[model samples]
Target: MKGTFPIEKFSHLSTPFYYYDTQLLRDTLFEINKEAGRHNFHVHYAVKANANNRILSIIRENGLGADCVSGGEIKAALKAGFPADKIVFAGVGKADWEINLGFDAGIFCFNVESVPELDVINELSAAKNMVAPIALRVNPNIDAHTHHYITTGLNENKFGISLSHLDQVLDHLSELKNIRLLGLHFHIGSQITDMDAFKSLCIRINEIQEHLYQRMLIVDIINVGGGLGVDYENPDRNSIPDFHHYFETFYKHLKLRPKQKLHFELGRAVVCQSGSLITKVLYVKEGVNKKFVIVDAGMTDLIRPALYQAYHKIENITSDKIEEEYDVVGPICESSDCFGKIVSLNQTQRGDIIALRSAGAYGEIMASQYNCRSLPKAYYSDDL
Candidate 1:
C-alpha cells in the first residue's frame, strides 16, 4: 500500500524537496517512550540521524536525551534545548576543542573509544581543574550480521576498545585522577534486524560485567548503543519498529547491578518512517528494452541508494493507472545515480509526483552539494 501524501500541496511546491509527517513522528516518539519507560530504560536519540533543527526540537520536547558523535552535533543538541546533563558525547576521534566543549557544558559522559582518546580527555580536563566522566566503549566482537561498513562491534572495526585490552584499560583508569569511569558501552552496528545478534551482545556484556564484578568494580551505567532497524520496504505496514521486542531482548538477557541504569542510543528507528524525499518526474525516456523515469532529485539529495545499495519504496503518488516496470534514476552525472532498477510503479508521466518512502534517518542529513546542485528544502506536515 502507498503512503498518504498531499498530492495537491506537493504540486505547488518546488520539485526535489523533503516532506515530513510530523504527526507520524510524534506518534513514533510516543511509542518509544511508552515501551522504554516500561523497563525504566533511558533512551538518547542518536543525533547523527536527521539533525534538522525543527526535528531536533520536537524530539527534545518528547523528553528523550541526545547522543552525539561530534562537537557540532553537541552544539546542535544544546541549541535544540536538550539539557546538558542529558547529552552524551561519543566518537572515535574527538578533538581537544570538542572535549573542552563537553567539559565546559558539563555533559553527562563521554563514550571513550580508545586509551589514547581517554588520555587526551583526561589531560584536557585536568588542565581545566575538572574531573571528566567517561564510559569505556568495549568491543564485544559480536557479529551484527549487517553490512560490513556499518558493522562496528567486531574486533577488526576501529570503533571500540578490544576485550583483550579491557582489563588493562580498567586498571589504567585508576592512574588518571581526572577521569572517572562511569560505565561501559557497546554498539554492534546499524540497521540490525536479527534479535539474536542483540541477544549475543547481552550475553557478552553480562560476561564483561561479571569480570568487572570479580575485580570489585561496579559501574553505574551500561549503555548498549542502538542498532534497531525499521521496515523500509513496508513503511505503511510498520511505521514504528518493534521496540517492545528490542528492549525486552536486552532486559531479559542483560544482567545489571544495583541502582545501575541502562541507556540506549537510537537514531534511525526514531525518525525513518516519518519522512519521504518528494521529487517530480522530469522525463520518461523509452528505451529499447526498458523504460526509464528520470527524476530531478539525484544523489546530491538522497545518496543512500548509491552509497549503501539501500532500498527505498518508490511510489508514483499521483498515478492511478496500471503498474509498469521502470528504472527510476536521477540526473546526476555518475552512472551509480540509479535509485532502483526494474522498479514497478503505476504508469508514470513526466510530471507525476514520486515519494521515496522511509527516508527520515540518513536521508537529508547525508545530502551533499555534489554536481553543484542546491540542497533540498524540508517541509513539515503542520506547516502545510
Candidate 2:
C-alpha cells in the first residue's frame, strides 16, 4: 500500500482507475534480481503483464530484460528506454512484419514455436543477410495444473513445438542458413499456484534436455519460462511472489551444465501485488437474503474476473463498518461481468472506495471499451 491510495487525493478524479504501488514493485524486482543472481539466472519482464510506462521504466532500471509478445510491446519497451539487446520476442503466431521489426532492432532472441514459424524467421534473416539466434519453444506435454485457457506447454495447447517434432526441428536447423539454434524454451502456463507443478516441469525439462543432448549437441541456454504465481488470495500477506522458492526450485531440481544460462520470463509474479483497481461503489441493492454492491468499474477495466473467473481480495478502503456478505458486481451489461460472487466485505454504501487487490499484473494491460466506456486511467504513487 504505497502511501495508501489517499482517497482524498482521488476525490476529484474519475470513479474507476488503476492505482499502482511502485514501492512494492521496486521491492519485488529487488528480490527477483537478488535471487536470480544467486543461480546466475536471467529474467525477462513479460510486457503483457502490465506494460504501464512507469512500471516498465522501474523494471528496466533494475536490469530485468523485457519479454515482448507483440510488436507494439517491443516498441513500448524500446520507448521506455530498455536496451534492444536485453529484449526477447516470443509468441505463438508472429507476423512477418513483427519478425522483421525485431530482427531490425537486434533483439536478444526469438522464442520460435512452430516449424513454419522457424522457416519464416530463417527466410527473413537470410533476406537481411543475418543469422538470428533462436530458442525452440517446446511443448513439454506436462500439465501446468492451472487454468485450461492459460495452460500453454501441454501437447494440445497450441503454443510450442511438440516432442515428436524435435528430430524434424534438428534436421531443419541444420538446413536453415540464417537461424542458429541455441536453446530450448518451455512455458507451462500462467497464474499457477502449485509449486509441485513447477517441480514437475523441472523434471520434464531435465528428461527433455537429456534426450536432446544424447541426440544432438550445441545446447547452451535452458529457458524454463516463468509461471510462478503470486498469492492473489492474500495480497497483503505476500506482496512479492515467493522468489526464494521459485529460484530455489530450479536451483535444486534443474540440472544445469557448466556455463549454461537459465532464463525465466516472470510476468505476474513480479508485479501483480503492487496494483489495485480503485473503484467507487455506485449503489447498494438489497435483495432476498443477499446483497449486491455495484461499483463504477466494469469488466472492461479489469477483465481477469470476467474473462478467466479470477479472484482477488476486495476491500472497502473508505469504510470502517462491520463485515457483510455481498455480491461484488460491475457496471457492465452482461451477467458474466461480475467480479466476485458472494464476497464478504464491510457494509458498503454509495461513494465507498474499493480496492480490487492484486490487479497489477493483468489489470491495466487488459483495459478495454466493450460498452463504449472510457478506458480506465492509471496513476502511480511515485507521481502522486
Candidate 3:
C-alpha cells in the first residue's frame, strides 16, 4: 500500500516539514486497542516518541494511557487530554521538580529506577501528605538486540534496578511510608524486532516473580515496557505493526497472577510509520564517482540517520522518471548529515519533493535547531 501524497497541496507549502497520515494513525491505534482489549491489557503511549499536540490529542481520544519520561512530557500529556490517573512517569534521573509535578498531577505510577529516586519520591509524597504509587523498574539484563545506544535492560545500563540489588531495594521500600509499591517494570530496549527477545523477557519476569512470591511480595501490575519495532523498509506493506502477535506473545509466555494487570509503554511501533519528513531537493550535484542529491532538510530536521545510522526509505514523489542511484545528502555542515547512500529514486532534480518514510516516531520529536536551522513544522493528512 504505497502512501498517497497530495503533491499539489504540498507544492504550495514550504519544504522540510513533517507530514502525518492521521487516518493511518487512527487505524494503527484501532488495531492496537482491538488486540490488547481482547486480553484486557493496558498500553501507555510513550510520549518521547512523538509529542506533537495533534498526535497526542488523537492518541488521547483512543483511550490509551500516557507514558512520560520528563516533566515537560507529563505536562504535554495532560494538556493533550490524557487523564492524570492514566499517566505513568519513568526516567533514570528525575529532578525534584519533576517528581513534585508527577505527585501534583497524581499520575498512576512512577517507574522508579534507583534507590535515591525512591527516597526523593517518598520525601516529596510525604511533603504533600500523599502516598505515591510506584513500580520498581527492574533490569532483567535481557539484550534487546538493538542499537547499543537504545538498549536499556542490560546490567551495565543505568536505566533500572539490577537483580542483585532487588533485595536491597525491597528493604528500602519497607522504610518508605509515603511510597506504595504498585508493581514491577521492565524495558529491554527499543527497535527490538525479534519476538524471541520478548519471550526471553517473559521467562525472566516469571523467575523474578517467583523470587518475589517467595518473599511474600505480590504486585498487582506487571509493566513490560514496549520496544516493538516497525517495518521501516516496507512501511506501506506493513503500515500497522503485528499487534496481534505482539500481544499474543505476552499472553502466551508471561505468567500473570489472577486479576493482575499487564502494561506496556510502546513508543516507536505505535507511531513510526504514520509520519514522514517532506523535503525538497535543493540541488542535484553530480560527482565523478558518485551523485549527491542535496535536500533542504538536514540532521537538524531528522537526526536518526546520522545519530543511529538508521535507515528510512526515501522516495522522489514528484518525479515519474526512470530510477537511478543517488546519494541523498542534506544541507548540514556535518559530513554525517547524509540520509542514505546509493539510494534508488526516480531521476531526481531540483525542486523535487522527497518523502523520508517511517519517521513518525523519533523524527520530529528529536528535531533540533542545530546550524540555526528552523524546526520542521508538522501537517496532518486530514488537515491538508
Candidate 4:
C-alpha cells in the first residue's frame, strides 16, 4: 500500500525534496518509549541517522537521549536542547578536540573502541583534571546476517575491540586513573530483522559479564546497540518496528545486574518509516525493450539504492489511470543512478509525483553535491 502524501502541497514546492510525516514520527517515538519503558531501558537516538534540526528538536522533546558519533553531531544535539548528561559520544577516531569538547560539555560517557582510544581519552581527560566516564565497545563477533558493509561485530571489522583483547584492555584500564569504565556496548550491524542475532548478542554479553564478574568487575550499564530493522518494502503496513519483540528478546535472554541500566542506541528504526523522497518525474524515455521514467532526484539526494543496492518501494502518487512497468531512474551522469529496475507503478507520466518510501533514516542526512546539484529541502507534515 502507498503512504499518504500531501500531493497538492507537493505540487507547489520544488521537486526532489523530502516529505516527513511528523505525526508518524511522534507515534513511532511513542511506541519506542512504551516498549523500552516496560523494561526500564534507556534509549538514545543515534543522531547519525537523521540530523535535521527540526527532527532533532522533535526527538529531543520526546525525552529520548542522543547518541552521537562526531563532534558536530554532539553540537547539533546540544543545540537542540538535549541535556548534556543524556548524550553519549561514540566514534572510532574521535579527534582530540572532540574528546575535549565532550569533557567541556560534561557529556555522560564515551564509547571507547580501542585501547589506544582509551589512553587518548584518559590523557585528554587528565589534562583537564577530570575523570572521563566511558563504556568499552566490545566486539562480540556475532554475525548480524546483514550486508557486509554494515556488519560491524565480526572480528575483521574495525568497530569495537576484539574479545581476545578484552582482558588485556581491562588490565590496561586498571592503570588509567583519569578514565572510569561505566558500561559495555555492542552493535552487530544495521537493518537487522532477525531476533536470533540479538539473542546471540545477549548470550555473548552474558558470557562476557560472567567473565567480568570473575574479575569482580561489575559495571553499571549494558548498552546493546540498536539494529532493529523496519519494513522498508511495506512501510505503510509496518510503520513502526516490532519493538515489543525486539526488547522482549533482550529481556528474556540478557541477564542484567541489580541497579544496572540497559541502554540502546537506535537510529534507523526510530525515523525510517516517517519519511519519503518526493520527486517529480522529469521525462519519460521510450527504449526498444522497455520504458524509463527519469526522475529529477538523483543518487545525490538518496544514494542507498546505488550505494547498498537497497530497495525502497516506489509509487506514482499522482496517477491512477492504470498499471505499467518502467525502469525508474535519476538524471545523474552515472549509470548507478537507477532507483528501481522494472518497477511496477500506476501508468506513470512526465509530471507524476513519485514517493520513495521509508527514507527518513539516512535520506536527507546523506545527501551530497557530487553533481553540483542543490541539496534537497525537507518539508514536514505539521508545517505543510
TM-score of each: 0.99, 0.97, 0.99, 0.99
> Candidate 1: how many backbone clashes?
0
Residues 1-384, model 1: lDDT tens digits: 899988888899998999999999999999999999999999999999999999999999999999999999999999999999999999999999999999999999999999899889889999999999999999999999998989999999999999999989988888999999999999999999999999999999999999999999999999999999999999999999999999999899999999999999999999999999999999999999999999999988999999999999999999989999999999999999999999999999999999999999999999999988999999999998
**Clash numbers, per candidate:** 0, 0, 0, 0
What does candidate 4's lDDT look like per residue over 242-289, in tens digits? 999999999999999899999999999999999999999998899999
The candidate with the higher lDDT, 2 or 3, is 3
Off by more than 4 A, model 4: none
Question: In candidate 1, which residue pairs get closer than 3 Å at backbone N, Cα or C atoms, i.e. clash?
Answer: none
**Candidate 3, 247-325: lDDT as tens digits:** 9999999999888999999999889999999999999998999999999999999999999999999999989899999
On TM-score, the stronger of 2 and 4 is 4
State the local distance difference test value for candidate 2: 0.89
Deviation in Å, model 3, residue 84 alpha carbon: 0.1
Residue 69 alpha-carbon offset, candidate 3, angstroms? 0.3
lDDT of 4 at 49: 97
Better of 2 and 3 by TM-score: 3
Please estimate how well model 1 matches the true structure, expressed as its whole-model Cα lDDT. Answer: 0.95
